[model samples]
Target: MTLLSDQMPCRYVPILAIRPAEMKALEELPEVDKDSMLPLILIRPWLSANTLSKSINRFKEAYGETRPWLADIDPFYAAALANDDDDDDEADPKKVFSEIEALQDPANGYSNWCAFIEADPRAIPCLRLDPNNINALTQEIITFSAMQRGICLRIPRAGFGGIGQIADILNAQNVTSVLFILDFEQATMNELSNAAAAIGLINTIKGKIPGAEIAISATTFPDSFNGLKEQAIAERGFFSLIKAQLGQFRLIYSDRGSARAEKRTGGGGLPPPRVDYPSFKNWYFFKPEKIPTYQAAAKAAMTHKSWEPKMKIWGTQMIERTAKGDPYAIVSPVRSTATRINLHLHHQLYFDDPPLALQEIEDDWVD
Candidate 1:
């Protein structure tokens, strides 16, 4: 019943068409979405705000906590934001990890979005700092501190066409486990190659961090996932490239979809919604969950049972950074998913029809 096995403990599955303005939608999730144990979709900010943290908090407080967006599973992931990449002289992830912890001490409060639940059986509370203004040490320190506290860090490797500074943060953090996200909209043949080319990019720097598990995630595009398709069909030779060069069995971006993934419209909305390319239109790279047996049986209703996966795996070496910067991110105001931090969510749904026929039970069900 294992859909996939990778270094990271779970696969974060995202939902698509998440608007920044409508991020408050998180507050009204049904039982499933609110269940901290299940995977979640991130609704990012419409436009990168200078005060990203405050804006999101205000929205959530005004609305409500839609899902358990703030719970921690066995491992924790705290993501950070940065924009000035390819500067070469950036603080590492470890430094960023430290910086955030110091700021969140209740005395500093400089970490505009810093907050710790201070509860066990808790998923770490991630800080989505100001992408444009966050310091070099911000991400590095957060990663380091969170991991020391037994939390995994989820850092956005904003692929804005560069050998991003986030890599240094990733290297600096060097925790035992971490989650990395890339945007398909920003993904490029070069960035993917250069990123992997940077050794310890996939695995944490040696002697710096140990037992770190890496997972790559991306946002899906409107219609094409050809990059991933080639990788899956090819058994993802690019991932092999990372294992050979980067030396990690981590899940690459395409495995989760497009990292610099663009925005598209889903067909419906609300407690019951329909999406275009529903299967692959997730917004973020989420840890996957166990499907309920009944839910698994319900796959029959899916538009297409089979997907000719269009995923790409890129583990290339370093190169140039783009002018726009590669650190775009959006966090829902909700604290955590109902299923989080060591609490695995397994549910059952009944599908009357699926994208593929192999799952059909009886003709009556299909008709």
Candidate 2:
């Protein structure tokens, strides 16, 4: 696929903690976090305006590449550091370059830590205790928050506190529905604890925002998950993790090709890994080879002792079923609130079924 397609990098889906609707809204805003945007600009020096072209050109001439970070000077810093002279002219690109150069130059003893201090000295051990520094840092954060209005919310993998921060913002924004995607490629206790806590926070806020729904989509690996077997094992782990934490689905929709999002390309640098997933198209979302695994996982997740009559319809069906095949089933959680998170684990394959063709299967089918 293309290095960067029109599609949002798939890797970010789980990071943003957004739902389908919110994801659509984000596509309109096309929010890019400062962290992600900065790196992209830094690596692709040509993205910078012509004013800084000279500095970029010079850097390219010297280092055989344009310094992407130097391309578009941070408007925040440019305005912060601008001269107050009555004559209004663009900030001197050369001076701007020099400051950034100084900030980056290790020869000047400006290590990353020093840059951090320079950017927000309040974070320093000594300064952190100072009220003035704290005030300044708070203001900086607030200002940064305002700047993020149009950007996608970039959720950090930091523990509970970080997740809490995300919760507060989403709640304030009246974002009720969320999809938390867990990338367990590199699992750890701390990470797991933080994730669980994050879910708890989401649950806590559900009372404030009525109709709030949160679902988790997790991927995991087993001792041996290579080639064809990989799909089944991954789904097993995905279901098991969610089941271990939350429990069974309230209702489930099992179709092979429904949610097999496009594979992602690893991120180039600091931003979360870039992904290349398919957009909303009528066609199957997953690959054709993985149908059996998806069916197996769905069967496992939706298994009930006996087909309860209530298991039939969870909510308004999103798609309609036809004689050709069953429509994808809708999966529901035991509880609607965040307290009982729902997990949708299935094999990764593209097994397209007719709209709303889901049939009630015996519990033994899943067992």
Candidate 3:
């Protein structure tokens, strides 16, 4: 079986939150998009332990194949699960460390966490470098490295100082095939500073490991769309800057797939109807104030100058169906979110090399 590490050089790496909307979006992706990227899924704590035990099957069903992908648990969510806390407050850091350590324990035999790595032999385990949990994280690296398949070490932008320690760990374990993810969650590009920092970090990693595959990721996607009609995808610009300095194939481009980097803590009542349309540079958001219904929003998106009538992706089709007064399409906020994400994924895949003849077809009627 070919390991996910061996399948290097994928175009994009989207860090997706594991939810119905996100999963549905992934399930509906075209074959070309599926083949072009390797998604790193973060398992949230919405499901019961029983359901989570069958997660690998769920992933296979959504993906339509046993293709290799990366898997990691949301630390805060896992910590809450470990302590059986029902509130939305952040769990204790010690509990989070313990929970992560427990997941790596082989003495307990098979566990739901183990299912993430064991059920699908192709699933690459993701390890976060935490100073509070350094020992546990190190042991996790060793254990996952023992699997012979490469492991992904996720280093947040702030954690760059620990790259030397990570290099030592890899060297001590004699693990060569590794994917280093420089995660800059919620951070946006500000001129060339962020890009320069990232370039320096990439250089440091290369100097340390010399053979480490690297991916730079972040999200400028806002947590709330209120008072915002458009937003620039700073991560894209950041990737462009780094690619210009280091060459195109030096690192992978990654993002949060148009979702917020930090998960919302509490449920805010239902969001106003909105449709986020991705263009080459920005996300043009449509939210009608006079009539705040999904159908109205979909109609606005359909009539917008940026709407691509020739684009046959599932998300666009959903918008078209909803605009035509199809009650079954985009009935609720969750479905709307799914539709947006589905479109976003397709957009990212074709961002650099757009399909020929994909120009917008003129509509017969005016909005």
Winning model by lDDT? 3
| TM-score, predicted candidate 3 vs. hidden true structure | 0.84
**Rank list by lDDT:** 3, 1, 2
Output the better candidate (1/2) by lDDT.
Answer: 1
| Model 2 spans with C-alpha error above 4 angstroms | 1-158, 165-185, 188-201, 205-217, 221-228, 231-367
Instruction: List the candidates' TM-scores in order.
Output: 0.38, 0.27, 0.84
Q: Write the per-residue lDDT of candidate 2 for residues 1-367, one digit (tens) a residue.
A: 1111122222122221122321221122211211121111121112344433443343333223311121112222333344445453455444444454444333322243143333421111111111223334333334333322111222223332444444455455544333222223233223443335534644554445444333333332222212321123233233335445655322111111222222234645432111111111211111123443333333322232321223222211111111112334322211111100111110111112312113442322110
Stretches off by above 4 angstroms in model 3 are 46-49, 79-101, 104-116, 128-139, 188-193, 356-367
What is the Å distance of residue 219 in model 1 from its true position?
3.9
**lDDT tens digits, residues 1-367, model 1?**
1111221343333322233323332233223323322232342322434333444364345234443332221111122323334445345433433433343333332333334333222233433433343463464346335534333334445433332454445455553443343322334444455444334444433334444434443322224322222222111233445556654444432332222234334755421111111222212112113532212212321223332222110000000011112221111111111111101111111111223212322212100
lDDT of 3 by residue, 1-367 (tens): 5465577878788888777778878888776678778898886533443344355455666675657788877655655555664454454333434444556454423243544576567688776455456566566666676677787877776688888777777777777788888888887545324577888888887877888899988888877677888878888888888888887557788887887777678876888878777765688788999998888888888888888888876788788888888888887878888888887877776677777225443433211
Each model's C-alpha lDDT? 0.30, 0.27, 0.73
